[model samples]
Target chain A: MHLVLFILFGGLCVAGAVNLLLQRHPINSALSLIVVMTSLAVLYLLLGAEFLAAAQVIVYSGAIMVLFVFVIMLLNAGEEERTTGSKAAYLVGFPGAAALLGVLAFVFLSQKSALGNARLGSFLVTTSDLSRVLFRDLLLPFEVTSILILVAILGSVVLARKEQ
Target chain B: MNPLLTFLLLSILKVAVVLVIFLTAVAYTVLLERKVVGRIQNRWGPSRVGPFGLFQPLADGIKLFLKEDLMPTGVDRFLYLLAPMIALVAALLSIAVVPFGGGQTYKGVEIFDIADLNIGLLIILGITSIGVYGIALAGWSSNNKYSLLGSLRATAQVISYELALGLSLVGVVMRAGSLRLRDIVAVQSVHGMASWNVFGGFQFVAFFIYLMAAYAETNRAPFDLPEAETELTGGYHTEYSSMKFAMFFMAEYGNMIIVACVATLLFFGGATSPFGHLIPAFGGAIVQAILPVLWFVAKVLAFLFLYIWVRGTLPRFRYDQLMGFGWKFLLPLAIANIIVTSLVLAIHG
Candidate 1:
């Protein structure tokens, strides 16, 4: 049951993600991105990372997406046509897509080698254990990351301000 | 702790109770704000829809329920719908790791305590931090400039405050010497009311910073620049309506309660009474275990009331003021507190 559920959500997420590349409308792309996020959250649950799943839904699906939509509306890009990249854009994109697909196919074809021992993959970190890693071992990175965020915030505010 | 079984059951129950209480509180919080604000301005607050406007929130809820569910033309329909759910879910999920009660055991069957995950405090912070994505998504998907700005402001505010908020907790974590909220409370139980970390000089400064940043992180007043009514025009939820809007509002209050609960658990000692008096009086049997839970709830409610009181009393800060206070004031204060705490501990230990 869990495996089937995981597959279903995974498929939906993949489909939504692909749609983002193909869709012309920015708003539509934004909407599909949300689908991808929600589906990914579902996948997290199936993977037994319930806390992570919940966080994914809350952060990515909720606040992050909302910001994207807001930016879309704020820019008023509705009337504008989707930017068409030159042959150079596709030159870059197609190969990128192909490489991703190739890697995915290779993983699918060689599942045993790709996945390794099931037990190795099965190891799950409880929320508490993750917390310890974050608070103790990862303390410096965590603190630095927060400071980085503060800098980004100040920079954005400065950039967004109107000249006097 | 039955560990696994309690984890599952407690997760479900805590989510449900937090959801209901949070939703109800959101409804009343709106009404209370309106009424209180009205009184402040020499006007009656919600006097119409059911006795001193007690039914106001219900009326507002019904209106949101009955309103049309709008899916803007050409907008990202999926994301639009998902935004509110994300917000509500994120807001609600943080409550899980909060240790509301001590424990209840009867003949090998644990009755109440939620998952006794060893890292409860970390779980709470992780969940709350991730909850910001809901607000961010709401802004981006709406395709409205106002909403986008609101979301951005909210994101920046939350991310900024989250730093101070999380850093502020380091003192508590260090003092407790354990990341488990329950363990932290256990440590606090040693000193009783007088010595709760809130009173531990350096820890007290951290607590104040956390409290202020938490108000901002949760987007409460004086720091509610994202939803600044005068400029943003309802902010990120500008385009949101109906139950979706209701859910977002509930999520905000829910987040508020979660923060309050966490603050209580970390600093006040979860479920331990003002002086550990209740534990001895009740005896160390099941009842004694349960007393701590009651004390925890009472402490949490007190903080919630403080949230409301501040909302009632303070005027909202201007955007720059909000940012300056966070970066300039709270951030420095928190860093200093941490330094002081570390030095003191190092010297003493």
Candidate 2:
């Protein structure tokens, strides 16, 4: 069951991410990103990060992606204009991307012995467990991230405000 | 029986039952809304299709199914077709977590609900949030200016109100100390109606905030700016016809029922009868099993009536006014309620 679910959602996440890059229209890209986020959320659930999974869906796919879609609609963004690029650029980009993937794969494979297999129903992370860690161990980081968000909000408001 | 197989079979059975009852409830809610609104306007509502319009929903369903499914030119065929299904599915999915009554056993089999996850409330919030995409895509896919505008308004309105909705629920969760709907209800059931979060936890403020935000979340009257018929024609569903249009209607009513059920479970003692303590003599197994379910259904019905009553009474808010109310008024109020609740909880503890 675990292997089947991992394969299904992992494949979907990759497909969705590829679709996000391939889609010409901004709305289509936004929708693809939502699919990727949702698939990631399922993966999070499978790994026993239940709260994180819910937050991923609620905050990322729900709120953030809605804003992205809203902006795309408000701006009436159309399909991306295709442009021809130099052939040499593709040669360098493909090889560079492949090299990066290879390096990441090597790193993951090297660490595989240290990682535990995720068994279904073996671990369950509750909300209280998450809150305990956040409030006790990561309090400072949480506060700082919140403050950063506030600053971003203020900056957006100021930027969007009309001149008197 | 194998435990895993039993669990799967029971879950499938529960899902089937809940879907059947929920669809029927949604169909009747539409009838209820029309009849109530008609009476408020001093008109006799649809009495022609069976007694007191009881069969109106069935007749309407048949009509919609039989009608020509129109596909307008220039529409995004895939997304336009997919949108209503998204709305209806998300709306229906939220019902899985809602506990209709206390846990029960029949013939040595236990059933609490369809699937009561520990993080049930958050799951509902997550699913409902995704529901926004249905309206957004529907409007965008229709390729009509009116549809696009309506969906834009809907997406903005839903997102703004969703913050307040989630914030308002925080106080209830804090008081319960668990995310499970059944646990929240159990906390309130211990002390009966007086200890309900609405009355005892000083959550009247949160309850009111939730009520208003829920109105906007479900896009009901006064907050129904997305489909403001006078301004945006049919709004996000302007280009949809036949069964596709019916799907959107079912989705909206389903959402209303889900919100009402959530409010009841969180604030109104859920399936716990107010007189459960007083009537100890009548606490036979049959009475114990049946009364709570009746009480639960009663509370949900009352909330649904209130939804319809408000619809009949209030005029729709202007677009700017609606946004201002959600962000400027409800958001601050919800935040303040949280602070006050936390302070009180800390002092009491």
Candidate 3:
């Protein structure tokens, strides 16, 4: 059952991401992104990170992606405008992306021997567990991220204010 | 007799029962609203339908079902069709976590709710937040300016109020020390009516904030700027017709019912009667079992009545005013409530 769910949603996530990249219209792309995020959330649930799964849907898919969709709608962004780019750019970009993927995959495969296999219902990540980690071990980084968000909000408010 | 198969079957049975009851409740809620609002306006509403309009929802359903389903020119056909279904489905999904009655076991199976996740409240919040996409997509796909404008307003309104809604619940979560709806209600059961977060925990401010935010979240008056008939016609659903229109209507009322249920569970005593310990002597196992369910349903119904009452009594806010109230007033108030609640809990503990 777990394998089936993983295959189904993982395939969906990959398909959604590919569709997101291939979509011409901004709204279509946004919708594809939402699909990808939701599928990823389901994956998180499968991994037993229940709190993280809910947070992923609430913060990422629910709030951030909604903003993205709202902006796309407000701007009435149409199909991607075609533009000719330097051939060298794609040549470097595609190879660089592939190299990065290869390195990541190699690292994961190498570490597989060191890490224990994940069994269903073996590890449960609850809300209390998450909060304990965040508030104790990662308190400084969490506080810093919040401060960074506050700064960003202040900057946007200043930028958006009307001139006297 | 396989355990897994039994679990699946029971879950399916629970889902079917909840959906049927919920859809019927949503239909009757519409009738309740119309009748109450009509009386508020000095008129008899739907009396000719069937015995004080008890079957009015059935009549309305038939009318909607028989009506012509329209597809306007230049609309995004797929998305236009999908939006209402998405809205209704999202609305229905949130009810999976709500414990309508206290935990009860029949034949060694929990029967009160469908899925009782530890993070139930958050799951409901997450699912309901996704409901915005339905309205937003419906508006955009319609290829009508009025629809577009209405959806934009709805998106903004929902996002703004969602903050207040989530923050308002933080105090309740803090007091209960858990995100599970059952746990929250269990915490209240200790003191019965007074033990409610609203009364005993001094969360009246948070309760009020939640009430106001929930009203906005469900797109009820006086915060219903999204579908202001004076300005945007039918708003995001301007181009929808037939069962598609009914879907949006059902989704809205379903959301209202969910919000009311949540409010009752969180701030009221849920299935716990006010008498609490005193009620044991009144009757046997049957009364013990049925009384709490009656209390739970009664509280939810009262909240629905409150929803209709407010709709009848209050005037709609201006769009800008609604935004300002949610962001400026409700958000800060909710934040303050949380701070005060945490401090009190810390000192008292």
lDDT for every model?
0.76, 0.91, 0.91
Give one digit per residue, the lDDT tens place, for model 2 in B1-349: 8877877787788789889999999999999988988998999888899999899999999999999999999998989999999999999999889888778954434454677788999999999999999999999999999999989989999999999999999999999999998899988987688789998767999999999999998889989988988989989999999999999999999999999999999999988987547657476777777788789889999999999999999889988899899899999999999999999999996
Candidate 3 accuracy as lDDT? 0.91
The order of the candidates by TM-score, greatest first, is 3, 2, 1
Question: What is candidate 3's CAPRI-style docking category based on DockQ?
Answer: high
Q: Native contacts recovered, in order, as a fraction for each?
A: 0.14, 0.91, 0.71
- The regions of model 1 sitting more than 4 angstroms off are A1-164, B1-18, B28-56, B68-74, B105-113, B283-290
TM-score of chain B of 3: 0.98
Give the per-residue lDDT digits (tens) of candidate 1, residues A1-164: 56778778889999999998788778778878988998987776666575686577656765577567656755657643656669887888889989999999888778977665533125565666766899899999999999999999999999999999
Residue-level lDDT of model 1, residues B9-108, one tens digit each, is 7567656775676577667767766876677677897798877889988888778899997765555576778778878887776665666665555444
Chain B TM, cand. 1? 0.87
Compute the lDDT for candidate 1. Answer: 0.76
Better of 1 and 3 by TM-score: 3
Instruction: Summarize candidate 3's per-residue lDDT along B1-349 as a digit string, tens digits.
Output: 8878888889899999999999999999999999999999999888888888799999999999999998899998888999999999999999898888868876566788888889999998998889999999999999999999999999999999999999999999999889999999999998677788789878899899999998998889998888999999979999999999999999999999999889988899787887657555467777777878889889999999999999999999988789889989999999999898899999997
For model 3, the superposed segments whose C-alpha errors exceed 4 Å read: A83-85
Error of 1 at B44 (Å): 6.1
> Per-residue lDDT for A55 in model 3?
92
